[model samples]
Target chain A: MFEGGLDLSGAAVRVALPELQRLTNELLRASGLQVDHAAIVTDVFMRATYRGVSHHDIYELPGRLAALAAGKVNPNPNMTIINKYAALENYEGDNGLGELGGMFIMRRAEQLADEHGIGLCAIRNSNHILASTPYVETAAERGYIGYIVTRGAPTMGAPGRKEKVIGTSPMGYAVPTENDCHIMFDACLAYASNGVLAEKAEAGESVPAHWGLDSEGRPTGDPAAIAKGTRQPIGAHKGFGLTILGEIITGILADGQIIDEPQDGTGLVGMPSHTAICIKADGLLGARRFRRRTTELAERMEARASGLQLPGQRSARSRNEMIGAGAIELKEPLLARLNEWSAKLGVQPL
Target chain B: MFEGGLDLSGAAVRVALPELQRLTNELLRASGLQVDHAAIVTDVFMRATYRGVSHHDIYELPGRLAALAAGKVNPNPNMTIINKYAALENYEGDNGLGELGGMFIMRRAEQLADEHGIGLCAIRNSNHILASTPYVETAAERGYIGYIVTRGAPTMGAPGRKEKVIGTSPMGYAVPTENDCHIMFDACLAYASNGVLAEKAEAGESVPAHWGLDSEGRPTGDPAAIAKGTRQPIGAHKGFGLTILGEIITGILADGQIIDEPQDGTGLVGMPSHTAICIKADGLLGARRFRRRTTELAERMEARASGLQLPGQRSARSRNEMIGAGAIELKEPLLARLNEWSAKLGVQPL
Candidate 1:
């Protein structure tokens, strides 16, 4: 979110969020997506922007449109529930936009939870879901606990191994609190994502030592070497283990590709898969009690802070600070690019 | 298990595993447990030994017996299902041994998965469950993808705070493969467990600089300071986020204690709770195909590993190597203490 735009001195331009959202929706719709699907995908990207995580936001819009033009994504997908059970289901996405599929499956999972206390839905053949936090946060917003995992293209290597055999494999878990405040923990298993490393390399800056390895599998602080080689997991074997486990559940179990069979040319592997889980908080502990307890937990942790911060705390603060301002900061070049795309796609410019 | 025995000239003695198992069961039963419950507890501990993780093994047996003696643990518990849903259930453990409750819940979860393609069970008021790996592995062995989380005694601190607010909150996830092998990923969220840190401190060794903070929340390499202060999470805030999420689901959702409400020195906060999830892997991917794919993934990784090992690979190897050895290693002092306990409890010595 902090570092995804072209260099333009040290100043960031403020742009109205509504205008940006409208531009995103218009561009996607003009780029061959249905209006509803465009809205869904646009919302996901925009949510990242509002949360100051533009790294996963509309920054990827151009690439997504390129994928759509290349026929890698089906805008009008006839998604179907291929298998169903009391609390679990598997969906075939027909290679639709990942955000649409993710939203579709998450909503279904919540519905299943409403009927059965807990629900799980696995989706395959969905293009890259930009981020998982929003999907899980959606469940938390609906007063239920949510969990989601999406297998990305393989770029991470196994610990001590030269072979790249896993995706960043991001996962998210969220628990709801009162006032719509939820604790959402979303992270990729990799210590650093390829995008971040590439950005560092472009800036000619050194990365953290644990970020990745060189071609020889030796840890390096050189960003260029890391970008060319492979990203490492956060906790060595532990994170590697989690990444593989995620691939098994979200990819293999969904009848999607694993790292062994890499998809060529496509920025994303063939319609990467995802798993969404929803738990009825009220079903476990009465909703009121759970909310009160979460508030107490958060307050207690805040009081104990010696400098450490909770997840989403910074994002929430950033969102609150910008709400009244009516505009969000963006790299000038990115803003210009969005306008160019709007002109090229015959959509109204921001 | 690797090393939990008392010092014995830097070497351990091999004792017949059956003999150790018999001794453990005898002591637990003599201390007040029913024979079946004792066997369940002994099996969980012995499994850790077979996997070369003696750190969480029978070394805890004496203390468990002490808890029973002190009436801190209920030897004869009336465990019951307090709440039930289509694919979920809450069990009241009535202060029973955690292993017994874990096994019960895992089996129930598997059954639920059989009926609903997925199942989840939460248990409350159970004594310590040695490791979640064995419990989730139990599900994998039954041909289901599994997950388990157990809240331990609070000893971990969140980011920025000097107060210990969360337990290591160990969690495990496993997927079954062919050849009856499972990829089991079990880990505590902390950078290092207290046991490991204490071991390092005892050996007059410095731990990793980032392992934990001193009482004042300043980073330290002295394991003693870390043990006395607060332990840091692995991957910093990412691990902290996970530990908090685990507590929410496994602890708070089960009506158990959280960091904010630190229970008094009862060794464990009131009957620590756990959550177990089992997914019917065959429900998503056909049984044969899923098994074959898992086998292929493991084989591919093994072939490419340049010293990087897959999770559970070493454990499986250790287990196979010891199966026919007819004995297992233990620190001489620990073995002697166990013998003394056997005699003190009027049970036959190993």
Candidate 2:
């Protein structure tokens, strides 16, 4: 967040947590989402926003409600279980918001793991999953190791070309510990996320070199230059390879819709597929012992590596801080847009 | 392999596949490995070498035989299934050559998947498993989607630090396809593999910038500078996070010995752990339909992206070419070392 950040979004806007939640829940309900579906979406959005996962955070609230009202997203998806084979479950999504399907499948996977030591669930025809972190974190909280991967909108350039070749393919993994710092990891295969890039571009800022490539396939630091270009993948080919793997497991294995026609989709809202695998940490060594190992690893890493930031630490710290303050600060423009969307939805503004 | 090569390693030394296998199996047997153990090691080595996985390829054959003779590694290991749940199998290795444990555990995982639709296996106390590719490929060849991950010697630097903080943590994934061209992906979390970098260093070449950082934490193009430096991760923070995730799922989950004592021990041979997961592709839409989906995805990607390289294509192509020629090539120094080690083991020269 602080790569010599350029703050051109004017002043910060503070909104109380409870107020924002009310607005989100009501807005979603008014848009025709069932109560349970609305709650799922609201909880996911809140958690992501508090964790500073800006890409899938509060900004999407308005767009989601708009999508629901316009029938772009299914208001109430059945999420039927199309196939069940022992520890594996395959669900067919009814073009619903991905968070609902993600949560539903992860819960089912946890249940399957409870019965069979491990569970893998794949859900297809789901829309953009804002973030994969929350679903994996859901399992980790239950003292289970969690893994989730989803196909993303195509944005990252392939090995050498500057055109869109594959999805960002966000993947999340988490290890539960005795304590709350659960050693979570979540990131898109791309070098940078579109949310951060868009934020930077709006701020008239330059991005880090190699974050993306210009139209000519040269690494450029200008965020605005990404308009006609593609995001750079991490490790070049290695990251691209990971993206392919993610898609295969989710899109191919789940028999989901993939964005194949457009190599370069700007802010695309294609149906994505998600895969979740969970393992009960109590399988071999009990959860307590496994958690001890993770805690020790964290301590050992902290003691030796001065600048090594352990995963899940930042988000946990951020969530704690936001809870303590009872509020979250958003860019003024973002808050205004959210209020505008709420007004259109006939809901009280945050 | 052709990253603007600096070719100082003399001419290519070709070895007949059958001759290489005989020498490998015989030398391992003479050193103390049982027939099955020797065969496992030999097959894994041959497959890796044929696929041009230089790091875990034929180059390590001599060192492994020496390790067996010197008792650094158990020649014949009893890979005991320490624990088993309905769908999970936990094996404890006896310091055996990791290739032996890898094969045994993957086979067990495959069997478990047959029974439960999915299987997850974790093996602890294993030596360095050369390449994770063969194990995952093993699952793919059996019409199942497979994944394998292994802990590595600490080599990659953590974020904002040039010193060693985490292992390279290589992971491999493969999708079962109708044809031999499965979508396979195998890569360490690091930006560049240590093996490729070491080969470059021996060639007296300047490496790619950001492949590693010098002792002073500055990205250096000189491969020689890496001796006292650390390998850079794929994405600065994202890749480091993944490396941690990999170690946890394998090292921590398996309750194995990790290389925690030394952060910068070059060429350290520590007890690593491995985790394998297998999912029968026939769980949904049947294997034939699943294979068609993968084949279609591969074809679609190829049609659009001019330079985008699909995963598994390279290794499959290399293996095919090597098979067609009935031979594999190695650098002259590697072949000389192999023959020297074979002579010491009282085996015929290569």
Candidate 3:
């Protein structure tokens, strides 16, 4: 459950992108990430905001830093290759910053794809990566089709059971396009994302009956009940099946150790891992032809459903609007917390 | 929609697996597939039955053959590589047999995973590959996580609309496990597969209310009405989003052209190019460690679920029981069709 709605007007703060990046780097450095790792982590967090995925934005920094302080997460952890092949590498993250380690693996996948026309990288012992879209979109921007899957904290309904037994288990796919309208989709297998639940709790709003179940595994609209019970799968058994698949792909296929029991504080922080596959579209088809065909297909889809919008269009539009506004809108309390954290870190307030 | 059950017992026939394979190969050969291609195609079809997925069985073969004869599909079609990288290949199938082309690409993926720890192969201009589970299971058996996606004939409901606008876009994932209990899942994005609708129509049964809508895009339970309309997404918008994602991944990302106009039937006929990625678990951790950990995870899932069985367990058990019975049990009328088709093909009745 969230504390309450934050009043943003009084706590509003603004900083140039570069200035924000510097402060982020500094804070991460203080938390033990190296320069390069800190930069990458900061970029991902900020990019989430730029893309209007504010839930995965800097709001997560305090919790992550607290984890580092509590020794629940490793700082200055090593990420080394455990195995290498023509277009693939298995990385051991040494319980490192998930954002840093995930990006590292995805970057490696991109490099391999550059040479092989396709690349796949899997990492074990990594922490949580805030958002998965950025990794795939990074590959897409490079004219590659990116596919990514990751397992996270369990908060989803299981097959045949109303109880929560799995994480949101997000999956992402991004395809490059000629214009800025890259086709990208990122979603959790759960009917609603955990962030949505948090948002509802903060607003003291009741969720839809289908969002989750009570502690007894009965459907309920109470956000508090969902917090104590299970989040419903996006499409019942289909989504539950997908969550299981995502877990298998990230937990088992990534060669990461799978911990069944909830261990640390909240739950067993499963040794997270991810699989990133990148395909060079242009390599498969001439760039012009690929673009022309994709455009034609896009036009066809639009014609078929005049009202249908591609997955990422709204997010892209929101991003552009936010950029034009020159400042991100944040809840007041969250902004206050950010200011407080900044003050404590001896960094200039945004 | 279906005539009363035909006399299956009087029409029942049994043939050795090898004999069936031989006849299947000959049938394909007669239909213009090369010997090698016929073998692959035959294997795919037989595998469906072996797995107890009779819906995708040889009963569908005659329609396909007729389609081939009508030039709706090509026989002896050439599958050409449009582009290639070390671990990736983009292929154009020239509207060839989906089963043949799909298997070829999956085999390539497996080989690449073995060599490079990962591999991806995407093909366009392919037809249907019955039962996606087999393809992914094949990779899982080889100790890799397999992912498969394909777009089928449009049958799914779109968001905010009761009309059909998307394919039954199915997604499949498989993870290797011990005790032949590999975690595998495959399902169409729709609330029900189109085959389910066909079955309902055949039985003169009404579908569930949520299953679909009538031709006017209004919800209806009449099987005939649903057949003429569109199948609802598994969970409304969520499933709609997934279907869209699948289409983009396999149809667009693969650089296979998409048919925009519903009237053209090109979209329906456009060979589904599959993108398969295999990640070698042993590459991330040592083979022994990977196996042990996966076994532990599998045990935990089995134990945690209590009365619930894993996804593929039922199908596996059914297949074993059917095989042990020395003959597959079939509804009487289907058995008659098999007999009739066998007789026409000059295959001796068992």
TM-score of every candidate: 0.93, 0.92, 0.88
Error of 3 at B19 (Å): 6.1
Model 1 per-residue lDDT tens digits across residues B1-350: 12334554546887897888888888988988887888888888887777876677777777677778888788899888877767888888888888889888898889988987888898988877887777877788888989888885657777645687677778888888888558888888887877788778889999866778999889888999988889877677777887888887777777766664655465444357898989888887788898988877777666655565787788888888788787888877777778888888999987
Q: Is candidate 1 or candidate 3 better by TM-score?
A: 1
Ranking by lDDT: 2, 1, 3
Candidate whose TM-score is highest:
1
Best by lDDT: 2
Model 2 DockQ vs. reference: 0.64
Question: On a 0 to 100 scale, what is the lDDT of residue B242 in model 3?
Answer: 68
What are the runs in model 1 whose C-alpha is more than 4 Å off? A1-11, A198-207, A262-271, A306-308, B1-5, B8-11, B160-162, B260-271
DockQ, all candidates in order:
0.59, 0.64, 0.50
Candidate 3 RMSD to the real structure: 3.8
User: TM-score of predicted model 2?
Assistant: 0.92
lDDT by residue (tens digit), candidate 1, A1-350: 22334444445888888888888898888878888888888888877666776577766776677677678678789998877767778888888988899988899889989887888888887877887777887788888889889876667888656578777778887888776557877788777766677667778889767768899878899988987788887667767887788888777776766665554445444358898889888886788998987877677666656455777777667677767688898876777777887888898877
Cα misplacement distance, residue A45 of candidate 1 (Å): 1.8
**Per-residue lDDT for A12-103 in model 3, tens only?**
55555666667677777777778887888888877666776556666677777767767878888878887776776777778888888778
